[model samples]
Target: MIAVRRSETTLFTSREATHDNDTVALTHRAGLVRQFGSGLYGFTPTGERVRRRLIDAVDAELRAIGGQRISLPQLNYSGIWERSGRWESFEGEMFTFENRDGKRLCLAPSHEEGVVHLVDGAVRSYEDLPALYYQVGRKHRDDHARNGLLRLKEFTMKDAYSLHADADSLDETYERVRAAYVRLFEALDLAFVVAAAENSVMGGSASEEFVAPVETGTLDLRHCTAEDCRFGVTDESPGWASVGGICPDCGGNLVAGEGIEIGHAFKLGTRYADAMDLTVDGPDGDEWRVHMGSYGIGIERLLHTILAQQSDDAGCRWPDGIAPFGASIVPLAYEGAIRETADRLYRELGAGETLLFDDPGQTIGERFAESDLLGIPRKVVLGNQFRETGAVELECRDGTTRYVDPDEVAAVVSGTRSGD
Candidate 1:
């Protein structure tokens, strides 16, 4: 129950916002985010609450699948990149700088090199064949940073690395991680598609990207419509448009749609192992290289995509599992029985954990406006009807409303109680 007073909050004024086809204008107008620089934004109290909810959902999904959470240094030594043969190739896009000691370093845009080095020192025997490590932290990139959270100079990423002794083991682990991502997105109530992807700079034989369609997205994918078919490929592939968007596997016609790429999984095989001489004692007493895979979810980009997909003329409509607050308590009349009923309902909703108590200083209209702006899934209003008929009105973000007893408001919002 997070208590909030509209008067005390510093939300973005309408005049301070500019409309765009993405989340920039809506989020700012609602006072959820504030722009600090190009591709950089600051989350307000309300925004941070939503962000944490998203992080918590992803973190739980990762841990449930044998992923051990670990933190690595953001500033990495250039020696690591050089050993991996990406130092020179990545020069134009790596954030490189020299320290006072003349030691070369760069903020890691990804953790392939770091993960390989860390795992090399930890696992020395075949007994540690299958190790899954993950970290949720900040990653820096030299991207041109555009389209709100779609691209940024700095962002948060949940990256998981798996080490295996054989190709079969790597494949199994990759599928498991991919399934975990499916669950994470389902929990977030995001509709997405998994499509074959190019490995590009992250040297690997195969890759797949999890994408969600949005009007302002930059990636275009052509998907097959054949029954039980899941084939989707990037539009950049040669002859994709000329083939009438055909699915290579099923010979089905493809339909093209634009989507924002949220997650990617790669089968890295022995690229890093061979480059860095990463090895362990095999079961037969011979040294063998490890097979690896990398999985990543762009935290900020995912959140922005969700908001863009779920938002409407009102504001953000967060899914139940990731909403900052389950519901809001708006008291139409600040005094008399109305306030009493509202106060009782607020306390019943766990006193700030599951419900938001709108400030009484604002008018009913003002409270409703703020309530809609924040997009709380359920809104309990104690107004004239409550004072007259002893029934409070429950309004959903979708504009559905019904009257219910004040004592049952909390349970109703929490999905524990049923009926009007």
Candidate 2:
């Protein structure tokens, strides 16, 4: 069981860091993250728990689709980028520097060139054609990072690359990955739209992005408002018709909104493979350049988008699978019978999944506020009601309250997985 104490963690209030963005303000006040610099932030313990759950969810989806998880180097030599003819193209956005030996190096903003270089000679035949490699790690960029985690100089990303013998094979994997991304976001309960996106720097034949609509989002998107229509397009896409334009598929009304891009899928179509000489011999002994696809999901950006859409004036309201703790045991007073009962329930409900509010200094109202601020899904209150009737007050995040026998607490909370 991971135990957390209020006094042991750094939590801010609304009075600190006066910002116009409510999501940013609530993030700090909830102790989810701490900003180190303009574009850099570190996750607190509470935040790390939620992040791990999100990452695990992503991993499960990708792995189920035959994505082989691998770790790639964060720092890349200029030779790889130059060979791919992207060193100069990515000049301003990539973090480039000259090492002590006068050789230029860069913190990779994306791993297309480096990943291609890593598998250049190893994959020598069509049998090694459909290779899907993915990694979760830090990616660096030189953007004007602002709006909390929406834009950051350094951030965590889940990037996957697929190599295929031909465009048809690449298309097969692209659709699979696209489906997996939809399932992932759906499982997280995020309201998002998958839109045709522009292949700008990544340079691909086609691309699509999973965008979550939020007021603080930077991407402009047009989506059909019809219940049956799922048509959407980014403003930068070639197929983008202006807002109030007719929906190409369903002839529905298209509305414009701001959205954050959480995931992107690209049909690279031999762009990197040809530029970097990633080739394989065919069954007929002919040399063929491998086609490629790149997919990415910004981890922190997804987390922030959830907060942007789900948080209320009280605090954050985490989705089912990503809450930091499944249930919190908040006793009105931690003494005598209340303390013993709360401790017993914590153990019965699985200590790791349940948070016991053991701090005695605060009143019951203060404890309830703290529990709501943390966005715990369920609150098990051992109060005067428990003392009189042996029934614990069960409060859910949706503002519903009920009283259940002490023994039924575990079964009720166990209906969902904890922090998974």
Candidate 3:
């Protein structure tokens, strides 16, 4: 039942940035997002719908693995970070401020320190080991944020931390979370690579990153071309993407490309545990440090990555699972049998996140054009086709059209969920 006149929509146009990435331009043109500052944006209703769908998909995967959802404060006391030895490391890059009482605080760039502090006193013995907790919240940093959603000063992240008593437990949970990330990207219909990576600020021994290959990415990597080989590496790795660009495993020539890093996981054996002095009573009645691991996925980066890879000159082509609306009804006229049939279909099937109707006084051509720009997966026209015959014209994002009964619209659109 959500209908809007295109003229009344508060969509503002945006100018291109230094990188010349058109996602910013196209997204603004579609009325999905607006920029208030250099890397800060406000999501319009249409953009927020897509963002919600993406988060829902991620949350479902997290809950499937027994993850306890929690919320952490965005403002954090600097004392905790000082204890972790990261205060000096993040000196200029963190948003730090001091109050009149000389109490120092900073906007949280990541919550590893905060999360460890929360679990510091909750459990006391080995039996309380292997705790898995996660939170979806805003993370802030003062770095040079650019390139639309790929890089931002403030962005949303789904960060999960697990506390284990032994390396075996940590290894098991790390692999589980990695597999869950694979499922998440697959659900979004994105082709991605899980590459061996360095644990830069997120310290650990074994680390990996989930990267999506796109033209607008800044991270460099070389991948193997062998059918069974799935190896990928960053430029920081020694002999990685070597002068000959040879694959280490199969000795085949490698292909170099840039990728957007969407998710990162680290096997932090005692990084945080030792720093925070967190320990538990072991089976031998001795104090033992807890093994820890952290995993994170950028929410907005996923949205922009999908647009960078899946869009064409015509406009974006939203994957069925992440599309704002599953379908749209564009009737040729606003009156007579056309409106009547459109209304009936809207009531029975177009309700919820399923449908939208462009009912402005513009011509049918304008309505169809805007539908393409919005990237709606499916479109139904209750025009002369429905008035003359009982068949409604159905149009797909691919420009294919078909005539079907009004009653069949729901089944056809709902069936797309399976393929998505």
Q: Which candidate is the best by lDDT?
A: 2
Query: What C-alpha lDDT values do all the predictions have?
Result: 0.80, 0.85, 0.79
TM-score of each: 0.93, 0.95, 0.93
Clashing pairs in 3: none
Q: What C-alpha lDDT does candidate 1 achieve relative to the native structure? A: 0.80
**After best superposition, candidate 2 residue 341: deviation in angstroms?**
0.8
lDDT of 2 by residue, 27-83 (tens): 888888889999999998788888888888899999999999999899998999999
Report clashes for each candidate as comma-separated counts.
5, 0, 0
- Residues 1-420, candidate 3, lDDT per residue (tens digit)? 464434556433333322377876678766677777987877888888888888888899999998999999999989899988888888777899998889999999988898888988787898998888998889998868788787888888999999998899999999999989988887787867767877777777878888777776868877777765656676655445444578777898777888888888999889988898989999989998999999999998888988888877767677766776677788887677777777777766645444445446669887777777778788888888888887999888887888989988877766754223
Expressed as tens digits, the lDDT of each residue in 334-372 for candidate 1 is: 677776777677678755354444555567787677667
Model 1 residue 160 lDDT?
94
TM-score, predicted candidate 2 vs. hidden true structure: 0.95
Between which residue pairs do clashes occur in model 2? none
Off by over 4 Å in 3: 1-19, 226-229, 238-244, 249-253, 352-355, 418-420
lDDT, candidate 3, at 3? 46
Error of 1 at 364 (Å): 2.0
